[model samples]
Target chain A: MTAQIASSRVQRSSDMLAAPSLDSILALTAPGMECVNAVILTHMQSDIPLIPALAGHLISGGGKRMRPMLTVAGAELVGYAGEHQYKLAAAVEFIHTATLLHDDVVDGSDLRRGKAAANIIYGNPATVLVGDFLFSRAFQLMVGAQNLRVLDILATASAVIAEGEVDQLTAQRKVETTEAHYLDIIAAKTAALFAAACRVAAVVADRPAQEEQALDDYGRYLGVAFQLVDDAIDYDSEAAEMGKGKGDDFRDGKMTLPVILAYAAGDEEERQFWRDAIAGFLNSDEDLERAVTIIARHGTVAATRQRAEEYAQKAIAALSIFPPSPIRVAMEEAALFAVARRY
Target chain B: MTAQIASSRVQRSSDMLAAPSLDSILALTAPGMECVNAVILTHMQSDIPLIPALAGHLISGGGKRMRPMLTVAGAELVGYAGEHQYKLAAAVEFIHTATLLHDDVVDGSDLRRGKAAANIIYGNPATVLVGDFLFSRAFQLMVGAQNLRVLDILATASAVIAEGEVDQLTAQRKVETTEAHYLDIIAAKTAALFAAACRVAAVVADRPAQEEQALDDYGRYLGVAFQLVDDAIDYDSEAAEMGKGKGDDFRDGKMTLPVILAYAAGDEEERQFWRDAIAGFLNSDEDLERAVTIIARHGTVAATRQRAEEYAQKAIAALSIFPPSPIRVAMEEAALFAVARRY
Candidate 1:
């Protein structure tokens, strides 16, 4: 391997340390999961060279492989020693990555996971088509799971995610966006997949109805918490550490949790700053800094974190319906840790 | 309705005459097909306002609705009177329209079917997202058809189309693009959906083995024929009548069949004109006109049309397995007309 590949592997190893170590959770994974993993690796092929290049560039960017891990973890938690869960896990990851591709294009974002986005390097058209390729490939992988319920849950989730994205585009810069509206958008855009990820695992495991519902609830709450923290980090993280300019939410005119909280707090000067900066009445680094300062002053980040904590608690509570297992415990811990992690 | 809407409606009526009148097609439609149509209309909804706006624009834009018609016709051709065909038909149209939406975005096209393209009016992001929304919804609708085979076929076709599109993007502005490469791209990007559409209809209809293969062949050949004509018309059509501006293939650096033929036949001066105009070396209207003149001089358009006719004949020949019916005859005629009418 090249020096760069070696360094990347080392970096990935370090990033893995940031999460609650999954050693105990991974122990329950059977040999069948490996088979599913192999299937996933084989099926990601694209006949077009540029597509595989773009896909490789994005996949090798070294984020925590949390979503796919969750799939395997969820299945293990349900005592599923079957091969299908691994495929489902990989399918969920592909779908997640596909959404990111489109999301970057839609937001015109240049950075993701501290690397230049695929759209930035390959242009929007290639990004969009490769995203579509991944979506189709993901669906193909899911079909291999051969479970109707999993298919239904996933297909619906895919539809809602697309709808949520379109909703987010229209809702941008709209200060009147209510908590209900925010929930709807986040549910569609983020939580749907997380919920489906867990539900599909339970489904392939052939879990009973009530247990399946509980897993879904846990996944949904975890996803909402994850996204809430993510939105908060967009404003709160330092520019260098975040690998992008700070206050991206404001720069993009997105009404994320912190901005929404600050708006609801109704500090007159803060409201004025937002009205000017995010509403396009002001355009300067000063306006952006002022807006971030106002959000900080109102303790919006703290409130967002508190909201995330509530979701994490709800996720842990939902797990009570499942039988005791190391994987389950790790999932509960992961939900808490997801909110606790920093850039 | 205003004069434009009235005229558009009249034009739609006349265009229907160019094939079979819509009324005749509807009158002969089996009861099973009516079910498919109803399901298709119900599933196209999105919570986002922009999606609906884009949909209205696309639905109103007067393409022949030939793809969906083929899907419905394919189902009926194989003695299928089932409810799933309509969902499949709608699914095919959704996939086709979704591609068109993305194509306009990638091609930087301003007009499609004689009106402002969706991207031009709604902005590229909205158009792209809405296109994605339609695609996901298409799969969801196909899933509702409850045939795993149909689901798999459509999913694979969607991937092929996306891959082919990426190939086109990478190959654009390259004068060395071969006829084989051009055919491969078009077959995947355009004809794959048509093949899948017909194949799914057969699968849902539970047709005999021979009939299924025959219909699949018919759909594939017809799709290739349709696309060839579309490509040929771009080299020399009357822009006012086609609603698509002429020389679009060259202007966009799209290496379609006519350009490939022109390259094979042109002298040094003509070849240089193509090389400069199409290879991004020059991009002026004068250059565009010169390129068009050279291609016409080489009978590239005629050669392309001949290839299209051959595909149409192949498509018609594939339907020999079907018993005689007016609907079957109309479908055969439609295949021939797909090439003959446009070019």
Candidate 2:
């Protein structure tokens, strides 16, 4: 075992002592994730027919099942022996899928995951209704899990996620949004679920409070890092296409951290350009180009990446309480990948 | 007790032996409803300002709180002696209110409960997010109630409701929709919640499975009757304006029972007119007027009410297991009110 570990470390030294990939975590959790996927597929089905068709469109789309993966990985890290985490992990994924469906309608987006959004094909009415169906389906899955502590964690996370979405809506179209407010929004909308996903594993495993808190902190910081990098990549100017449509936040007049930082650091003339662009007056390709250029010149995208690294480090540190298993190594490297990935 | 019952019966005989009013049920469940209202107010709150504001706008509007009242009244009829029903009742109302907010967006309505809909005033995006918030809060409250059976019932009902909404969306503007299909839609979308709302009370009261099933039947039948009348009233020219904006079904190209019946019985020319109106080619006020005239010519509105009367009888009959009591009488009369009220 020591020889294998030494050889693996030697092999990864050229890649900063660990491979910047989710491969380790994905491999570690593959068996459990198969069960989670089965649970998700089973629960998303409905006699309505349209419900499954619409939900399957996005669920089968290339989401990577990141949230549910966190739940499974956390369960593995805690060395849980029960099968209850399968339904709970699927429930987490359902919550995430539901949010994506509603987010498409809320932003009136044309594309998601490099394809036409469910709202565009299914129409807004069906999209909204299907989102509701998936959300209700999520609760049903949680109830089937029969763990009230885990149910409460996910339920509270869901409410917080909705409030964050509403907060983002209220903050839309304003270049004056502060960094603190932006962080708050992302923390609620994204990190709350991630935290709950990890925390519930410890709850179901009957781990101590300190272990649950550590897992919660790990997932929360990783979620923030993931979202920050995502926002930065929207204007990265050199990255390939990720899952989401590029320039969506710009077109939607969303005040993400990169834009907020850029707006704060701009000259008067640059600020005027931002105010106009984010106000929806300047939304052409050329306008998007100029906005990207301004952000790049201000180096806020790089700054955003730098901030993401800090969160990723914190996420890694949150796992220090756990023993140094390969699962721990995979989880820490996954945080690095969250910061390092461009697409 | 017998003398008082005789006196009340003699007094009610002047108004047809059972009053066409909700006053009886309201009087019986007033104290319980007070607690439900308090729970609703407490739970709808959020740190985000817009959530409570948007939710409260429609919640405080005069909609009679019928779903929650069913919960409270069911508890009374079952002789429950606990406070948990209050939270469960409030949870039921939250589910209903969440759907209403989403319905406003789905239908693109200008008014709800005789006032400006939340979607109209707060914009569709905020309305959708707030609806999500309330839904999550509903489950949170249900978790606090600590009854997995009640949670399963409500969760199942919520998914059915969403499926019904999606099914309706699929059936919209298609005049070939069958009556059976329409009934299926209404039963799933509207009656499922009502059934779950009543049944949860029995579950929390720890009643026999038979009692739970009985309450479910009563609520399901009452909901169908209530919806049948609501649809009939939309096309009923003799009726005064209910809370909803009149002619909404006509304008939205919805195929309710009246329109379905009118089309089935109309002459060739009338059928063509029905198709044109339902397909959105002719949605003027004059078109709505002509549509109503044609429906009246076939007497479908009266026929629809006749159908509602049958369901109301079934609803009242579902209470046969209960012994003679004022609460039982009040519930039976409420079912009658579901049929008799013009609005």
Top-DockQ candidate index: 2
**Candidate 1 residue-wise lDDT at A38:** 74
Q: In candidate 1, which residue ranges exceed 4 Å CA deviation?
A: A1-37, A237-240, A243-245, A281-284, B1-27, B30-37, B237-240
Q: Write the per-residue lDDT of candidate 2 for residues A1-343, one digit (tens) a residue.
A: 3568635733553475344988777777889999998998888988888899999999999787888998998998999999989999999998999999999999998889998999999898899999999999989988887888888899999999999999999899988899999999999999999999999999999999999999999999999999999999999998888777889899999998889899889999999999998899999999999999999898999999999999999999999999877778888888999999989
TM-score for the A-chain in each candidate structure? 0.89, 0.96
Q: Give the Å shift of residue A27 in candidate 1.
A: 6.1
True lDDT of residue A240, candidate 1: 32
Q: TM-score for the second chain in candidate 2?
A: 0.96
Worst 10 residues of 1 chain A by lDDT: A5-14
Give the Cα error of residue B298 in candidate 1, in Å. Answer: 1.5
Model 1: per-residue lDDT, tens digit, B163-282? 999999999999889999999999999899888888887899887888878888998998998899888888764423476656677678889999898998888887887788777877
- In terms of lDDT, the poorest run of 10 residues in model 1 chain B is B20-29
Q: Could you tell me every candidate's TM-score relative to the true structure?
A: 0.91, 0.96
